[model samples]
Target chain A: MSDSPIDDLIQTMGLMWSADGGPRIAGQILGYLLIEGEPRTLAQMCEALQISKGSASTNARLLEAKGVVRRVHPVGSRQDGFLAVPNPSHSLLKSVAKRLRVQADEISDISARFPDERADAQRRIADFAEFYRQSADFMDEWTARIGPARGETAQES
Target chain B: MSDSPIDDLIQTMGLMWSADGGPRIAGQILGYLLIEGEPRTLAQMCEALQISKGSASTNARLLEAKGVVRRVHPVGSRQDGFLAVPNPSHSLLKSVAKRLRVQADEISDISARFPDERADAQRRIADFAEFYRQSADFMDEWTARIGPARGETAQES
Candidate 1:
């Protein structure tokens, strides 16, 4: 294990997110920001992680676009700083539900294109679509049950 | 769109599953088998998908291992046949819950390594772990609610 707890956490998160198809460095940056609990300039992050300024900048932008990270500006500092966004879990779940809905819609459209004679095949496709649609609906309900304010309160306790 | 509805469905499923980090060919095979609703020999799958026998066999084994597809043997048939496994959505949700549990465990272990002075970081890590843990629990409850028999009955209507 690394001497620094933060370093270990960053590496672990990087691997975890990479398993879910995200960029490793972006995950690390998010991990670092979450642990720091304060905005960090691109230069500072690059130095801390020993990565190039270009890589750090690129990933910071990507993470921001994903709604898990945000850019902040200090009162007098010219350089922009980045921090992990609050309520990331909610954002992630919402995006996942959105994607699943798109997939379900596509499956439904494809099923409709089939002839009535292909009932079995059509039924299978419809089932697949329903599965995704239901899963998305479940996410919506779950999110409402665990709304951001309540989630934060739960975490504080 | 292709003249064959099967082809269009397979392509759409291929894209959807590939986005979730699964092999595109494996998704296509799963889609094809689900629609075919009958055991298909490896050669037939390859011919229909215009893929090599090697690729078809490899993806079929992969899907089978994932529990989304099953191998079937007909009486006195020399060649092995494959079909989509029943209750695949249940299996998939269960597997996802399992993976989330593993992630939560990892996060917990990492949190234990943090020093007392790193309280903020430790809290954030613990919160992250909790999110995954709760999500896994949700999946468990969801899976039980949609058990195989119930799921099939619902689909029939």
Candidate 2:
């Protein structure tokens, strides 16, 4: 109902990230930092987003851990600030690929324990494992290709 | 810990699917059906898995919707039996790719609404959109390559 474009965009990203298994608040925090394009203290984030200080802090830490956000400390200042990591697309893909690799390894190990009579089931599981492994490899290649752009952004910062 | 290998495998699959955003019970059901390699009635699944009838039914329906399970009716029987679909790896990958495509489209649309002054944010969003779009295309190509094997499995059934 609110006709604010920025607010709508933030809410949309929040929903998307929530669907991706992260907290909606973390997505909102990332959205805010991306659009604001500046380091913001926890207090400023809470004030601007009309969220509780605890919520802001918790989500900020979560996003930071996920490599989508980073902590910043201004010179001569005791308070910490947060900023969205530039070009987080590669990190996000890598995280997903890492999880898929874990799944693949787990399934492969499980299939190895199957009895000879269950060879069919074992083969099926192996196929699934192979699919995940290949997918992870593809993602790794993509991450490498994007590495240069990410490095350039880091240098600019 | 139970020394039952099959139980351990199903539990592991449940954990993986839970992480992938599906219900754990659905993953367990898929695991069970994959190993069992035969059509099973809802009652049989409930009794074998020691799960309640409600849980079995709900999870079975969920798996079926995800293309991981299929319901078959035995000739002259009123009850429906479920079997793990052949080559679910392709379906699973396709499902993930479809979801990513949807996310890419959503983010692309959001980026289009950004004001001209927010070009930096717009460009970042565009890059994220492209990454997801490309990932989806890669998955699509993989799925197509596996189509023949999937068809052979279907013919065997």
Top-scoring candidate (lDDT):
1
lDDT tens digits by residue: candidate 1, B35-71? 8889999999989889999999999988876667878
Native A-B contact fraction in model 1 = 0.67
lDDT per residue as tens, model 2, B54-125: 999999987776677888989988889998876676767777788889988987888888889889878877
Q: Each model's C-alpha lDDT?
A: 0.82, 0.79
lDDT of 1 at B50: 90
Structure candidate 1, residue pairs in collision: none
CA error at residue B39 for candidate 1, angstroms: 0.9
Q: Judge the docking of candidate 2 as incorrect, acceptable, medium or high.
A: acceptable
Candidate 2: tens digits of C-alpha lDDT, residues A1-157 = 6756677768887898888777888888888887787888999888878899999999998877667787888999888989887767666777778888989999899889988988988887787778788878877877786573342222111
Residue A134 lDDT in model 1?
Answer: 93
- Model 1 CA deviation exceeding 4 Å by range: A1-3, A149-157, B1-3, B149-157
Q: What DockQ does candidate 1 have relative to the true complex?
A: 0.64
